[model samples]
Target: MADFDLEALSLSELKKMQKDVAKAISTYQDRQKAEARAKLESLARDLGYSLAELVGTATKITRAPAAAKYRHPENAAVTWSGRGRKPQWFVDALAAGNTASDLAIG
Candidate 1:
């Protein structure tokens, strides 16, 4: 362990040291976790089963991007899926007395 002269360090130096120490701690923790995981995986393999088989790997279910439900009146390329917050152009069209159905794609 390297001895740091805390009393001799300036305010900026102390802050930099604090940040370095925090980063080092985080890096050390990540390394430890990786090592532990590797050990567990090796032990699991030795027991005649893979880590995923023993732990039950999570299957990520992701939805495909929503089809464009509305198209820009002026710019045909600009479109929205009618999901989440309304876009600025859509809001403007609505403000100009255009109905949602009017802006909707065929």
Candidate 2:
């Protein structure tokens, strides 16, 4: 590392150097982690297994969106799958004494 003449540096120069040092320190861990990941991936490839396969941390399997189970009383386009939270229209319909079976798509 080059020796910094701290006493010779002006206030602005010292502040700039401090900022640069802080940035370098902050990114050092990220750089190290990337390098380690690359090495691990290479080793896993040579061993005939992917890193995810070995670690069992593969991407999650997502299901297709649920089929619409309920339809809006007035709007055919507005529908709900009946899986998550009820929609405002559905809530209003229920409050208006409309049973859930009344909105069934069938």
Alpha-carbon RMSD to native, per candidate: 2.6, 3.9
lDDT agreement of model 1 with the native: 0.96
Point out where model 2 deviates above 4 Å: 1-23, 45-53
lDDT tens per residue, model 1, 12-69: 9999989998999999999999999999999998999999998898999998999999
Candidate 2: how large is its RMSD? 3.9
Query: Clash pairs of candidate 2?
Result: none
Residue 2 displacement (Å), model 1 = 6.0
Clashes of 1: 0
Relative to the true structure, candidate 1 reaches a TM of 0.73
The whole-model lDDT of each prediction reads 0.96, 0.95
